[model samples]
Target: MKLNSAQLGKHLQGKLAAVYAVSGDDPLLCQEAADTIRSSARSQGFSERQVFHCDASFDWSLLYEAGASLSLFAEQRLIELRIPGGKPGDKGSSALIDYLARPAEDTLLLISLPKLDGSAQKTKWAKALIDNADAVFVQIWPVETAQLPHWISQRLAQTGLSASQDAVELIADRVEGNLLAAAQEIEKIKLLADGTPIDADYVLACVADSARFDVFGLIEACLNGDAVHALRMLDGLRGEGVEPLFLCAMLARELRLLSGLALQISQGTTPDRAFAAARPPVWDKRKPPLHKALQRHSAGRFNHFLLELQQVDAQVKGQAAGDPWSSLARLCLQLAGQRLLLEA
Candidate 1:
């Protein structure tokens, strides 16, 4: 049966199923669902758990061996397969279909895959799994810009804490809706608090000096006309262990939002209306940089920046090969007018 993350806990409370497939772009939700399945099965005497990571070089026969293999301890087993790229080749697909044809009675198989798009879900492999396994798909929802405050409050409540309106707004400003980063920040706050009320002061103290910097910071610094600070923030992001490709993604997203807003404004939309039209940042402070970015940048410039990010993403994925960091650094230099390129 098909289920979302919200339905997973209750579904898992009863007897464990023979097979499960957890898929989504929301990493936190996806991992949580997978953990729930694994944890529940372990509690039900499925002590032997096997794991496989599917890479380009992975052999599909491994999954076949996994399905047919018996546990050495003569106990119930759980096999987990994670497909990062989400495209298992012909052999892998065939193996999965065959295994699901008659899933083992005592063994619970769990598969974690990246979010499957419409095309993928319609494929024979996906159909066989959906038709056979207990499937849960946790799709990421796009947060509305105006509903950010409510979202923050809800997120906080999950950690046995509550936040003041101002605190919600403050965090909303800082994180701007990158849910993964926002979730991490909440975990940090939960660790620091001593059963006291979490307010704006608590948020400022916890998040204001965060070591991690995302693409939003880079675009914000650039729009604020602090090219030096922008570069420094970019460097800090690297120091914080943020991947170069991810950084490029943030820049790309910011540019897309800015360009879309600028175009709307040119067509005679007001700032408040534009703000309403924009996607809410993972943090509320993001609204201001987005606001400032709209003022400082032309629609054309933002569009160009997005294209640069796309090029970087493509290169990092190996579709177009090059030194990704060097390409990223070059993009930054251009942002600072340290490199010359013809304006598109």
Candidate 2:
């Protein structure tokens, strides 16, 4: 049966299901849920654990073989299958469906994956796992921006520490939506607090701004037409030693997604529908910025920028004689709505 993350703890109190499927984008919550299951399995005499990392080169037959094989070290075994990319092609789909039809005796199957979009949820294989009688499906969602401060306050209280309202807001602003960082910051505060409530001054003094600026965030800034913030974040990433080639590849990927979505929208598809139809589908939290970016440029304009990105790629690899950083800054400016000549 399907369950939310909060209900997972109580569900595990009774008899455990033979298969548990955990899917979500919140890394911290996902890991915690998986850990809870693992701990319960160990307590229930699941002594042997086998881990498989699924990727493009993964062998599907091994999964079948593992299920058929008996464990020599322990009576009960746990098999962990991690799919980093979240798309299990035809072979994987068939294998999963078959395994779920009749799971191995004395074995528990745990599948961890990224959050599946609506289209993925409707897939036959996904449906089999979620609808199966012998499986438990738990989906974890990220905390919204508006609720983060309260979440932080709750987490602090769990650690036997009280934080002032301003302190909670300060900590929340620094961590952004990264819960792992938020947890770590809470622990740091707990250690620094000496029988006193955490105040804004203490948070400012103890907690450094750990906000990470990823390529996706940079794209959002550019899409929102905040050239100064985008450039500042770019400089911050560069100062933190983020590779120019990686930055170029990330920007190019975003542009390509926008190009595809824009083409579909131009052909009379709604932005929401186009986003859902796009490959590696656009996430819901990111759709607003993506739609904004689409509005700022046409399909042809995005195509042109893709070509410019190629030159930046060549320059980064030393195939061309130009400063890649300068070119990247120019590309960032252009993406932020500045009309500039593509550097030669």
Candidate 3:
């Protein structure tokens, strides 16, 4: 069974599953989902915990050992398997399928991974974890801009703090596409809330200008086909220590959006109608640059960029030979309609 973060809470109220798989494009939500499972496991007498980090050199048998081993201190335990790359390879795949096939009694297996693309979800190991009757998959997606304010409001309420619409809106603006920062801002404000409903003035006084050169801005620059601005923003983001994987991830999101809209436009759908039909329904203010973006690239080219991003991912992970930053700059330029004749 698959559930979102919202649904996971209510699901946890019932008996916990034998295996749980959680993945998302957003690290914050993924972490929260895993944490929730951990908490639920603990409350249900899973007092012992073991964590395994899967890497290129990881031994697959250790996972099997972890699953079958008897707990030393507690009768029930939680075993966590974290696959940052979201690939379990041949041996690990077999191990996962075998372990999940006969998951240990009195143990809860929690597998956390990076967001699995559609193709990844079809893999043997992935299907074993997901399609198994004893397993629950929690897939977390990023909060879109149009929904960020309400998300912020809900988050604020959790901290025993209330905020005016303008206040939450301001926080949303400062932390657009960055939920970690939004959560931090909310925590920071909790210390200062002091029994008063937050207003924009309070937010302005408490919040710092920390969102300079965020990925969303870089995306907007690319969508507008402003090569110079996009490159500069890329440089700024790199200078600010943003991971190339993160930059690539956000850029890939826009490319997906562009690819979908481009296909629609190519099939006789108006850009306006395509935007309206978008999964999240593009906001009016964000549609203009996307409209411009649609004019510059064909749907095929957008897909090509996404394919190249896979190489970028490999490079970032040191599995490929080249600088991902260089690749990203090339993508930025090309995304902005500036096709380069040579690789820099």
Best by lDDT: 2
On the 0 to 100 scale, the lDDT of residue 234 in model 3 is 89
Per-residue CA lDDT of model 1 for 155-203, tens digit only, reads 8898888988998888876765566667778888889988868899988
lDDT of 2 by residue, 1-344 (tens): 99998899999999999999899999999999999999999999998999999998889898999999989999999999999899888999999999999999999999999999898999999999999999999998889989999999999989999888999999988887889999999998888788866899989998977887777778788988889878877887888899998988898888888899999999999998998898877778788778777888999989988898899889988899898888888888888888765443
Rank the models by TM-score, top first. Answer: 2, 3, 1
Best by TM-score: 2
Please tell me which model should have the higher lDDT, number 1 or number 3.
3
Which consecutive 10 residues in model 2 have the weakest lDDT in total?
Answer: 335-344
- Count clashes in each candidate, considering only residues at least 3 apart in sequence or on different chains: 15, 0, 0
lDDT agreement of model 3 with the native: 0.89
* Segments in model 2 whose C-alpha atoms lie over 4 Å from true places: 225-232, 241-286, 296-344
Overall local distance difference test of candidate 1: 0.75
Q: Write model 3 residue lDDT over 118-150, tens digit each, in one string.
A: 889999999988899999999998899799999
Residue 71 CA displacement from its true place in model 2, Å: 2.8
Q: Which stretches of candidate 3 lie over 4 Å from their true place?
A: 212-220, 224-294, 297-344
lDDT at position 122, candidate 2: 94
